[model samples]
Target: MTSVVEHDTSDQFSPATSPAPEATSEPAGRDGDGRAARSRVPALRTFLATAALVACAAAGGTYVVTQRLADAAFVSLEDAVLTADALPVGSTGAGVVTEVLVTEQARVAAGQELARVRLAEDPAQATRGPRTETLKAPMPGTVSRIDIAVGGVAGAGEPIITMYDHTELSFEAKATEEQLRDLRLGMAARVTGPGLGRPVSATLDHVKPRVGADPLLDAPLTEEQKVAHERLTVVLVPGTGDVDAVSALVPGLRYTAEVDTRTAVGRIPAVNSAG
Candidate 1:
């Protein structure tokens, strides 16, 4: 037994060897494919982000252009004045004013006595007393101006008072012929002034051709006169809203008017022709 153990001693003294581990190719390949897919995700996200930014920029540009076009379609006139129906009170015969029954800014009705006048005594007819006459308003209106005082001599056809119909309110403006071409009846408008707390809605009533030269010009004619001479008188009436506010405005008050040409563009043939 001792001799048999000695025979395997040299083999036992050598190093012991174990089997090698197997390579995991399948898991490595799967991990490589997953990494490739993850790398593509960032590129796809970047592409989508770029596309969205471009769309937003395009939409903004379109809105700006549309706004500019809308603004360009409108026309504005700054030289506008409020006006009303005016009637002048005049004497028929030469006389002296004896008494003034109506005061300034007094509301009166038709046939209401405003003043009394005494005719000059005739030297030829000594027995006749001074002929007295009473002056009455021809129409219903407010007394705007009183030109004669008590005991003041008034000639025939001389104006003693001026009355205005406040109910008939209108806005008058002057525009060049070229500008008038773009305007039409029934077009929407907005009137603004220092007296008006907010813009008053209005509509175009008339566009009349001005006769003779331009009344607004005081200086000599220049190159500007040629184009400005043929002006159109534009009249605008209050809309369906509170017209009382517009009527309260004093005549001759300055205001700015903005005409909405958008609706008039297609509805009115003249506007299209001008364009």
Candidate 2:
């Protein structure tokens, strides 16, 4: 019994060793995910580039079409100016300018006293005393010029002052024969210039044939050629009772006029050139 107990005691006392763990696949899975994310980036960039190109192309095409349409429907003139009738203020008879009540460029109302004139004494009958006559404004306007000064002699019916009515302003322009053919009386127009808050809406009031010298023609033009190439004067008046437009206008101020050719008002009839 003693010999049997001694056998295998060392093996029984030894501790047990555990098995090794299996290799993990998590690192490989992360590598695959990284590759997938990198592959998607180029595709997203390509899509954005394509969208941008399409937008730019559309915008360019739209601009070209819009410009062509505008060119077809409008006629423009750059040599335009604000114009009005010049009202003359005159003295009734020959006299000496005694006093000037208003200065040049001053605004005067209708029938306002503008100046005083002393009548000249008759040479044959020296009995009459010096008569002073007060001159009045003919209409409400801005005084543009003062022709007579104090102590100056004025002739009968002489213009002592010149004025302009601001309310009756007009847009005037000179156009060639070809350009005038595209426009007609009563056509709609727009005038724009510096200090004008917005484009003033207007209507073509007059289209008159005006005699003009063509300085560009170095050689004398034939009578027939002159008749064919005669220039025209176009006048446009702003909308009636438009105080803002009238107030914004100044005489001799430059402006641009755009005439709408698409409107039916005063449309020119087409003529056949064929014989």
Candidate 3:
């Protein structure tokens, strides 16, 4: 059975080739969609930018309105100064200053000796030598001024040194009677000035009873107007725990003050009482 096997050599002779994938043409809308998306990018960015600008403008307008309302709620003082409760250190007795232990602006502790004085010899007294008197600081404070130098004569009860307590710092401002009516004790205040790092928070402390002639009243006026031109002093102390504001302030430094007169402190109480 060795019969000749007629193998299909024709199939083997045929070239091995595949039908080219039917020429895939992208959807006609695909290119148009891509171009449309690319064109929209700039418009989208521009829309976003316009939206952001509108939001910023609204915020700026709101801020301006808020600032105006805040200003309306306050009583302003153009002339204000940082100050403290001052103490005059005086000579205990008439004497000539023999030694000065401290200079101006010196920090002194309570009962610290500031100077020594040689008392004048009393002719009535049997003492042969002049008594030496020691001048001491009455409180812990900074020496503001030295009125007498070594060898200068100081009278009894005369101020030899002027000092102020730093812890008692306050802003002193001049206001008229009408402005005083709007203010109350414990009202909040804001202080701004050249030396301050930022606006300081304070509290209205008191209104000094003494009225002084207004230094700014330079224009000629009738006697009645002059009488009405008296200026009143208002004091504001630093808010509690604001030590940085107090430390940054130096006494006698000029500043501007704004007192919040619309606070509920005085108004609520008055309304309740009336009701």
Question: What are the TM-scores, per candidate, against the unseen true structure?
Answer: 0.70, 0.72, 0.68
lDDT of each: 0.80, 0.77, 0.78
lDDT of 3 by residue, 121-211 (tens): 8888847878998889888888888888888999998877788887778888887766776777777888888787778888877776644
Ranking by lDDT: 1, 3, 2
- Name the top TM-score candidate: 2
**Model 1, span 31-139: residue lDDT tens:** 9999999999999999999999999999999999999988777778777888887787877888999999999878899999999889877788769978988899988
Minimum summed lDDT over a 10-residue window in model 1 is located at 266-275
Candidates, ranked, TM-score? 2, 1, 3
> On a 0 to 100 scale, what is the lDDT of residue 37 in model 3?
99
Model 1 RMSD in Å is 5.3
**Model 2: per-residue lDDT, tens digit, 86-179?**
8877777789998989987687899999989988876766887777889898888888778998999998789777788877888888666677
Once fitted onto the true fold, the runs of candidate 2 whose alpha carbons sit more than 4 angstroms away are: 1-48, 211-229, 265-275
